[model samples]
Target: MGVHYVEGDLTPEAAAKVERLGYTAVWIAGTREPRLTIVERVLAATGALAVATGIVNIWYAEAQAVADTYHRLEAAYPGRFLLGIGAGHRELGTDFRSPYQALVDYLDVLDESGVPKQRRVLAALGPRVLKLAAERSAGAHPFLVTPEYTRRARELVGPDALLAVRLEVVHCGVEAASPNRAPARRH
Candidate 1:
């Protein structure tokens, strides 16, 4: 586990400071910004901290591009980087018919492009998806979740699948942040 939100644009020096703060890993949301460069910068800055793309939107980056960047980072940083990818929200209104199918397709592309399953994880939450993650990728990276959900996710993912939870902690004015608490998710 590590700090929930690692600003993707952090300077190498500041990212190193984050590493020095005892966080085992730093998760940068890659959907909004391409993260391979940031991962490299952070890895260059710190010797031990793992860098993970919290969730690289599958629809945005092609499999070849993802694989190329992944291979480049792995070659440079070894086991210090983990690729977490997802199909993204339906609200974004992508025309894809089925997210699960798209994910499977994306994984197929990733595999064909030479990205090993062990080096990647899926941004999954529900049981079916968690099961798919366990069978296909290294594990699941769940966002906006509670400890109870983490426990359930672990159960659904089985014993071997890595269950990484992305927790957001807001260090702002009390009143300004209290309302940011995530409501309990249903199913």
Candidate 2:
């Protein structure tokens, strides 16, 4: 797994390097829309590296648009694309009522539009959403989680579902100072 910022340009050259380095996938974070063009560019540049949205916000993107993009990308790239979607945080000023139902509705549209179960993942944190992901989509993508959380998530999703977790690592040597002063790292 690798992290790419939505604001950053994941150039074809950079994507090629990621593939050459033996990384299986490139994950983009805070994706509010279905950035199919970016996914296509990465897939075109690399032979096997899968480009996944760390999360496309369910509230912001239209389900039909996402399904259309998924179909197009699937046709062009085959099994090299994974759509990771999420219900964004309520703190972000979104109308966060009944997120579970909203996600269910979104997945329903995708299903209707031909985005298969194995081609998608859900950004699931709680038990409800994690169960939904396991039942409805491919698996669960949980961010900034601990080993215990991962273990619990795996149990919740069951053995068949994919469980991808985002872990953060911090290197602090003798020279390292405060949190802000030290250069933090993530993986």
Error of 2 at 142 (Å): 0.4
Question: Which whole-number lDDT from 0 to 100 does residue 82 have in model 2?
Answer: 90
* TM-score of candidate 1 against the unseen true structure: 0.82
* Residue 16's lDDT in candidate 1: 82
Candidate lDDT values, in order: 0.80, 0.84
Best by TM-score: 2
Model 2 ranges off by over 4 Å: 1-9, 90-96, 170-187
TM-score of each candidate?
0.82, 0.85
lDDT score at residue 179, model 2, on the 0-100 scale? 68
Give per-residue CA lDDT, model 1, range 107-159, as digits (tens). 89888988888989999988878998999999999988888898899889888
Steric clash pairs (candidate 2): none
